[model samples]
Target: MMKKPGSWRQIVWLLIFTLLWGTTPAVGGLFSSLSTEKERELGEEFFLELNNNYPICTDPFVSSYINRLGHKLEAQLPPHPFKYRFYVLDDPSMNAFAVPGGYVFMNSGFIRLMDKEGELAGVLAHEISHIYARHMARMLDESKPVSIATLVGSLAAVLLGGPAAAALLVGSQAAGQAAMLKYSRDHEQEADDLGFKWLQKAGYDPRDMILAFKKLNKQRWYAGGQPPIYLSTHPHTDTRLVELANRLNMHADVLPKDHDNQEFQYFALKVDSLSGSPYQLLRRMTQAAIHEPNNPAYLYGKALALAKMDHPDEAMGALEQGLKLDPGNYFIRREMAIQYFERNRYQQALSLFQRLAQTQPHDETVLYYLGRIYQEQRQFADALSAMERVQSLNPAFVEVYQNLGTLYGEEGQLGLAHYYLGLHSLTSRALPTALFHFRKALVNLPLNDPHYARVKDQIARLEKMKVKVN
Candidate 1:
């Protein structure tokens, strides 16, 4: 069972971040934003941490399927300031958490526990409620002084006096770390109630919350020695089950109808069909399709299985059938575009993305890919235009910055190239790319160079910062 977080472990994490950031408040602020760039950096870091710290079973098809579900849920969510992104942690522990902003994380164990779509949707909606309600931000606000001080002090000590001071700084914060996780039982109940509502509004059965709890309760007895962590975070399962049942009964007339069992099965098949060894996946997918030829998701799964098996022609045909059945599915269109792009059919990919972007103007991904297609066609001007629009829409998208940098460098706009490359450092890939361009630009960068000098300093500072891996 999951208890309160360990004081010593929390201290170690705080000190690690402190040493990494060198106690610079400015740098701390830089990493603290709710933007996509910050989220990606934090997401990748947290993803790596959870994997290293926990047990997980990896399956690509399952991962993609969960993400697809998350995307659909996100689209249905009411507007919020933060960008919600979901990640499946490769951990067997049945636990989930929402970080600052809209990062909803789930372990593979949670995925394995999901027997029906509503159960999965219930979990997702629960996590999303935490995010929408700013639970993480509240946690941070309540815990920040200690957390940030420990973080800064550790880093400052490390930078000034090296490893010994860093160790001491970290050890100091180990005393009060448990205070961070003291969320009241009321907070848990509130999140649960709102989560149930969210699921209902999203066309899921409100009763799934109780069903999910029932599943966990059964697992607790069946697994004897070690009940899942999910049991720990979500306390009083029986009480919650009763509460959900009562609510469903009271609101029966207003509630969404029960979900389709066949639909849930189709959803599960989408993951199972593409998740294992390519040959195994292909065999399962083909057999499944033969048994359920009319299911669009099954056809799509077979396409994914074919793709994994390296049978592109077969995959293309399968994808066509799937698309014919579900024309409005952006995921299908996006995958089809990817296939065409891989085959050097730029025009076809461009056409599809263009239509998608027209309806989804704020979709930076579509815009980014559109820019890529233009660039591949040597339409630098058009490429620049598309990328520029994306930059305006989401400046934190470092890939767009990187693309712009490359275009500028190729076109001999050294000043522009340096600036763009420098901004690209804001992305999660804190690598040599930024420094490489900085060095190249230094030759042409005047002491008073507008873009080069400013960008160079940011790059230099970031280069000095270190990252601590958990």
Candidate 2:
């Protein structure tokens, strides 16, 4: 069972934010008719708070997958004001939520619960619709003047399974919270309609959303001893599901349903493996493997669960058995190579990754892992070469930035090192650290370098956030 949050927690958060911002959140006014700029600014502050307080999943592959899938759906929509960013929250809550500025977060547990890529797409599409519709701003516009701190406290309360939101629902503030809830429900319906259209438009099955809702609403928290936070935030109603099902008749004859996605297994397994409670995951995957003896994903998931549980040798044993079953499985092979590296069996890892890289030169995972192996062996030149290649292949590979910074620093390239480190911090949303490193980069980088200009632009943005270089 989840612990109910005390009133003090909400009060503390409200007090802290009030002190930081020097006023209560004029929730109704500040965002009432919030311009795009103001919404973005608000989102920036909230996201910064979230990043500082929550544990964001940092697995390069997992992070990249969520962003890729999110942006893929985002591209289906017409041009928008904000650049969409997706993050995986490192929590076991079966919940997903969107912040104002085109930022959507999928909890690791939520992502793990999803069985199909289309289902995941459905979830993303819904969140995307919410952002595109500016529902938060609209809700504020509709609400009676409420403090921003009250909104934050309410959110904090909901997160804690506390009473602030429930408390607000029935008092002098009842009308405001009641109105907010009504809007929330209405917004969910609108998002479902829009998300259905967009998901189908983006070549995913519209029915996936219905399936996802039923699947989630019917589920108990798999980690056990935890409440269904998804229900608290996004209660999937029978009526809502019925309406969605009936609405599907309108698009009955749409051609060529796009339902299959090869990436789902790897993506789901990755999230499940990194879950907070690996013991539960291990047992789950182990039973799954027993049922489907040849399912590579289950075997792979089981090994990863073991690895996460600190049973490296057992994980290696499981992987070796899995590899024997399916020698050609790329996911399994890549994982085996990763295990080798983790255990300091660098030669084996290097050999395996090199061969994998030969076949997959454009694969960021293979290239990134190869680069790390090379860096570990003191092959600085090779490491830099591989890391640089990875960067050229996918500049958004955030881990590559940090590794490149380390490699370049080892090569005595301080300017490039600082620049890459700055890039890493910037992407990680560590504004102060980003500002510090970007300033250091400016001192050492030539004025004419393209990176110098990039660094300056980023520094200016950070400064706008009150993050000074000095």
What Cα-based lDDT does every candidate model obtain?
0.60, 0.71
| Model 2 / residue 436 / CA error / Å | 2.9
Tell me the tens digit of each residue's lDDT in model 1 across 183-273: 3466667777888877877788877777766776787776785656666545676776777788788888887777766545544544443
Where does candidate 1 have its weakest 10-residue lDDT segment? Answer: 154-163
Full-model lDDT, candidate 2: 0.71
Candidate 1 local distance difference test against the native: 0.60
Compose the digit string of candidate 2's lDDT tens values, residues 1-470. 11122244454554355433534212324334556876665565455445444556666667667877888898888779997778877666567777667778788777777878988999999989988998866665566655444444343334423333344334333334434532357778888888888888888888888888877776653436344665555554567799898899877888346666656787778777675567887888878877899877777888888888789998988888888888888878888988898888999998998888888776777777788888888999998998897777544345578898889999998889999999777656566788898888989999898889878876776665566544
**Cα deviation in Å at residue 393, candidate 2?**
6.6
